[model samples]
Target: MDDLLSGLRMPERVAPGALFLPGYAASIEREALRGIAAICALAPPHHLLTPGGRRLSVAMTGCGAFGWHSDRAGYRYVSRDPVSGRPWPAMPRSWRDLAREAAERAGYPGFEPQSCLVNRYDTGARMGLHRDCDEDDLTSPVVSVSFGVTAAFLFGGAERHDPVRKLAVESGDVLVWGGPSRLAYHGVAPLPRRTHSLTGPLRWNLTFRRVTHRQGP
Candidate 1:
């Protein structure tokens, strides 16, 4: 991992224990996209219903031992896809390696993620600011990888109403947050009308999390 980090550009510190690594995944773009395609083919992407019964703007799917899901019952992780009633596709090794590498580069080493939630955003799609506190462990950092299109990321304090710092993130960017900033509120702004050679009009975000400390999917 040290050798790989040496080839990438230096990461910018977003906050205490938070890092924004621009183009950090550029070298693995092809493998990452391929892995996403394979995972979605089996599980497919669908908008999830929030506890309020509102449909999410972003289409979501995932691979790994546990997949994040929500539908009126509140947010949680499941071992299978609710839509297909099948075990969520296995996370690709390449995806796992990339996530670990990114986390290590950001100073959060030993991030063994059990979930990789993939969000697909199109024009006008957005995710409201929220904290990732549903994980079984809070010590592990959240590593996010972006592919296709460009979006504004809202990084805020622990409180939802706190001031937010917006950052423009392009394809191949990777952001990791943990430690003091582990539960910080963050999200993506509505995407503008745009297209990328790899994802067309869609923006892909893969978030890796250590969902559970125990075994079994």
Candidate 2:
């Protein structure tokens, strides 16, 4: 069964109210990667330290009205960037379109996102199992899209100890979670290093959300 499942395509997301859709960006790989590159040019990915004073290995940057931050203080979203003191880059149309489309497919409508967290994963980068509890609005769904090399997506139950479903997230795949499954513990496993024509040596994930707090100028 393990072999059969592995051979299966990206599964239909089954997280109650959570929605997952895979987009084939193969037709526009160049544009998609270029959009990501442009965003990186605006705000390069950097290792961020958690409140526990531990620095994450993945290079990350955010583009949108609100960006997620984790530091000595804690993990939260802020308006202006602590580094540039300016607003984070805006979500590119491709990113926004993919997010909105995923949300709609997931049965959530009118999802206007104000934040797009872009994370870059190299060979060993992995985001441990965690719940997205920082958002003020739990009603809004979280939309995540994968591009470049494939990775294992860990989607667990509400509790930390519950069993999890491992899904293979490939480039152009979108996952949406909300309603009953909004807070399910989810994250990426260690990414195997591989080169792609577009993303080269890494995989990119764009997480879109409607942040609870409003951004300031």
Candidate 3:
């Protein structure tokens, strides 16, 4: 599926309530990167082991009120950082603003994400097909921002066997999905060994989600 979707193109609505905004984060790239660095400083990224004892290739950390975690116990959200035994770093205003604006542009207005998961993918790292179903509220949309090297995003339907479409996601791309397609399965293909001017040989992904329906202070 290489070159299936050309790089740096106009916004595309690939599915119902799912919109891809290419280079959407270009304006705030520096601030976003800084925010990520701060969050990682507070809660450094770490590889998580799956229930079956397989270690995830991607290193992960998070900011905001909740942090996504997976272990032999199960996949769920925790308010405290497992590493530091403290609350996850607060979500940066820039990060929240970008996420809210992106969600609104994708037709999901008034989105207030309570959690932002930061994932770092190095060469050969790939995520398997799975749905974002751990959130307490499924009605809210998910806003994802991509930075560093380009990646092929796999977007699938509701069923596991459903056909998938590959889309090339470059640095500064923002993807928003919710409503009817809230639980759609998706994953990232293995990243090729390449270097970006800003992030070197790695790719960073920020996924903003409204984990609960409760309002934040």
Candidate 4:
């Protein structure tokens, strides 16, 4: 949002778009406050409907070229933001830099993310396992950065029958998944009742993706 649009840079962590890495973005972590400030400017995290009317406890917002939204109509992304009926705030330069570095570190090159889904978690908020298939393009990998509170990142295989791998993610951690790992069902388990200095009693997750509404390469 307007309040968070400070143009800052974290030259430490920059990468391509395929390989998944963790804890290599300390500079980005320090600059996260700036990014959060910007996200709050556009769409503050608000519990949204799950199409079935179930209220999600986590506050969800977004930045970049498109923002993700879900309602009774189903899940999708568009140029216009549902909240202000204006376009989602442009992805901050900090985000772009980090994603590029993380992607490159993970082995992918030239990763340009157009959508950044911001998920804010309160003490008890949790997200169930779900595959991110709304993007018309499944070939692109997903790059995510964890901030604030610590939690378990559940990374599952393609089939539900396949067990999940729980990875402990603390602040300033980045995860990248593509190729066979891209379609894996991943989610955040409930945050234990805890608080932090920078993040307070919450968890902030920034997931960057390249979404194609109707077509892709």
- Which one is best on TM-score? 3
Which residue ranges in model 4 land beyond 4 Å of their true spot?
1-20, 213-217
Best-to-worst ranking by TM-score: 3, 1, 2, 4
Which regions of candidate 3 are displaced past 4 Å? 1-8, 215-217
**Model 4 Cα displacement at 48 (Å)?**
1.4
Q: Is candidate 3 or candidate 4 better by TM-score?
A: 3
Candidate with maximal lDDT: 3
Task: Show the lowest summed lDDT stretch of 10 residues, model 2.
Answer: 19-28
Error of 2 at 143 (Å): 0.4
Off by over 4 Å in 1: 1-10, 214-217
RMSD of each: 4.6, 2.7, 2.4, 7.8
Error of 2 at 188 (Å): 1.0
Candidate 4 per-residue C-alpha lDDT over 121-153 given as tens digits, one digit per residue, 9 for 90 to 100: 888888899888787667667888888888887
- Write model 2 residue lDDT over 100-126, tens digit each, in one string: 777887888877788998899988899
Q: For residues 1-217, could you state the per-residue lDDT of candidate 1 as single tens digits?
A: 8638443445788888899998988888878888889888998999999999999999999999889999999999999899999999998888899899999998988889899999999899999999999997888899999999989999998899989988778889999999999999999999999999998999999999998774534
TM-score-superior candidate, 1 or 3:
3
Ranking by lDDT: 3, 1, 2, 4
User: How displaced is residue 24 in candidate 3, in Å?
Assistant: 0.7
Instruction: Please report, in order, the local distance difference test score of every candidate based on alpha carbons.
Output: 0.90, 0.82, 0.91, 0.77
